[model samples]
Target: MDGSDQGLECLRLLNEIIADFDELLKEDRFRGIDKIKTVGSTYMAVVGLIPEYKIQPNDPNSVRRHMTALIEYVKAMRHSLQEINSHSYNNFMLRVGKSAFN
Candidate 1:
C-alpha cells in the first residue's frame, strides 16, 4: 500500500492490489501457496503467527489470545511503518519457527 501512499496515482493502483488480495484470500489461492503476507502499509494485513501458547480444541480462550496477539502485531506494524518510510515507501517474511497446516 506504500505505493498507494505515494499519491493519488498510486492509490488508484492500490485498488488492483487490494482486489487481488481479496480474491487470493477468498478463493483460497494461497491454501497451498500459503505464505506470510506482508504489507508496506501498516493499515492493512492480517498478521499473527508463531503461537506462543499451543492452540488446542475449539475454545474461545485460544481465539482471544490469538486475536490479542494479532492486534498487537498489527499495531506494531503500523507504528513501524509510520516510523520508517514516510519519505520513501514501504514492505513481511520468513518460514522458520513455524509450520504450515491448512
Candidate 2:
C-alpha cells in the first residue's frame, strides 16, 4: 500500500478499535466516566466530570471511589484492546496514564 493507502488503513483500524471501546464503555461498570476525544491512536476519557461528580468533588470518599472507578475502567480497557489486537495478531499494546485535578 502507498503512504496514503496505509494512512487510510490505519484510520480504518483505529475506527474499529474505537467502536469496540465505545461498546465496552457503555456497560454499567463504567458509569460517570465520559469519553473526551481520540487523537490519532490516543484515547482520552474523564472521570467524575458528570452531574453526579459535581456533588462528589467535596467528599474524600467520593474522590477515592472515582479513583477506583478510573483504575477499573483502565484495566477493562486494556483487556478489551488486548483481546481485539490478539485476533489480528497485531501485537498492539495500550499504555494508560491517569491525572487527578483538585
Candidate 3:
C-alpha cells in the first residue's frame, strides 16, 4: 500500500495500542513491549522514509540519531498516553550514508 494508507493504518494501530496501555500508564507502571514496541517500530518506519535515520554500519551519527529518536518516540508515546508531554522525535532526524551533518 501507499505511504498514506500505511500511515493511516499506523495511526489506527497506535491508537489501539495506546488505549491498551491506558491502565498501566495511569498508575505510571508502564512495562513490557508488546503494546509499545510495535508503535516504536512504526515510528521508525514512518520517519525513515524521508526525515528519519536508521542504524547502519560505519554510520555512528545515523545510529545515534536513530537511538535518540527511538528514545524520544518512546517518551512521546508515554506522554500522549498519560497526557504528560508532547514530542515529535526530531532528535532522530539524521542523514543516512553520511558521517557529517552538512
The candidate scoring highest on lDDT is 2
Quantify how close model 3 is to the true structure by its C-alpha RMSD in Å. Answer: 14.7
lDDT of 1 by residue, 13-97 (tens): 4544444444443333222222255464322333233354444448877666655655444444344444434433543211123
Residue lDDT tens for model 2, 1-102: 789998887787788888887887788877878899999888988888888664275699987887788888888878877887887667778888877676
TM-score of 2: 0.82
Q: Tens digit of lDDT per residue, candidate 3, span 1-102?
A: 999998996676556544644444343222211232333534222223232233464888766665566455466565454442223322322222212332
Candidate RMSDs in order:
11.8, 2.0, 14.7
Better of 2 and 3 by lDDT: 2
Which stretches of candidate 3 lie above 4 Å from their native place? 1-54, 84-102
Best by TM-score: 2
Per-candidate TM-scores read 0.36, 0.82, 0.34
What residue runs in model 1 are displaced by over 4 Å at the alpha carbon? 1-52, 87-101
Off by over 4 Å in 2: 1-5
User: In order, what lDDT does every prediction score?
Assistant: 0.43, 0.81, 0.43
- Per-residue error for 50 in candidate 2, Å, reads 0.6
